[model samples]
Target: MRENEPHRTGPVLIVIGGLPATGKSTVGRAVARRLGGSCLGIGTTRQSLYAFAEHGGDTDTLRHAVTHGLGYSVAYALVEDLLSQGQCVFAECVNSRKATRDAWAALARRTEARFHEVELLCPDPTEHDYWRTAGRALAEP
Candidate 1:
């Protein structure tokens, strides 16, 4: 088996962070698949939160904060669960803030698991803008 194979033993938290349309989700999923673990996306968590809140009754700011808070909690819980099961986990999020990145590092320390931070970026501004616009258009209702 490969060095990063799930059966190799030891828990790992693979954190994938990037801007919109930077392919964090795709890379995270690919990494998780290669490692035989699971992938979690903050966007998916946010969508679930919106569904749970019935898409109403809150200001956008409040909704965003709540969703982000819950998403972080859920990510921590997932990492803990996978660690307990001797499995690896891949998490994808924007994670633009230092505090957020530190929190993942702390989680790794608390869980005594290996942590890998992968930051995806698009070097070409024009191509990045094009991809971001296309992604936004595809994601819109």
Candidate 2:
């Protein structure tokens, strides 16, 4: 912070979530780009975590952690730090459960950051399935 800069209240944390083929990643990245902030994606983070574990971390345990709540826990800590520095953040996740969604909201409140929730939905099953299959085609490998 500059010596003469105005005091910041809090940064913004935009939560983008939805089903598997709801375009969470696409929308999260675009919004983060447009807003000039950072994006923390669960899928991306999961891959990174698993790759990091390449040193000695067990694949099964890592997978379980990522699937359960480890990803969100890590994101929460990261967002807390970023928000403390007045950096806006965009978090994209499947967020298939109420508990996950509430955790994001709670993080915003705890950090005193503005909470913006954007839930993407593909109402058309055909389009949704197409995206899902197309996404699978572009595997992480």
TM-score of each: 0.84, 0.85
* Model 1 agreement with the true structure over 8-117: per-residue lDDT tens digits: 56778888999988999888898788868889998887777766666567657657765658777776787778776767888899999998899889888888888889
Give the TM-score comparing model 2 with the true structure, all chains together: 0.85
Tell me the lDDT of model 2 at 7. Answer: 46
Model 2 ranges off by over 4 Å = 1-9
lDDT of 2 by residue, 29-88 (tens): 886776668898888777777777676858788878877788788888998899888888
Worst 10 residues of 2 by lDDT: 1-10
The ten-residue window of minimal lDDT in model 1 covers 1-10
For model 1, the local distance difference test gives: 0.82
Model 1: runs farther than 4 Å from truth? 1-7, 55-64
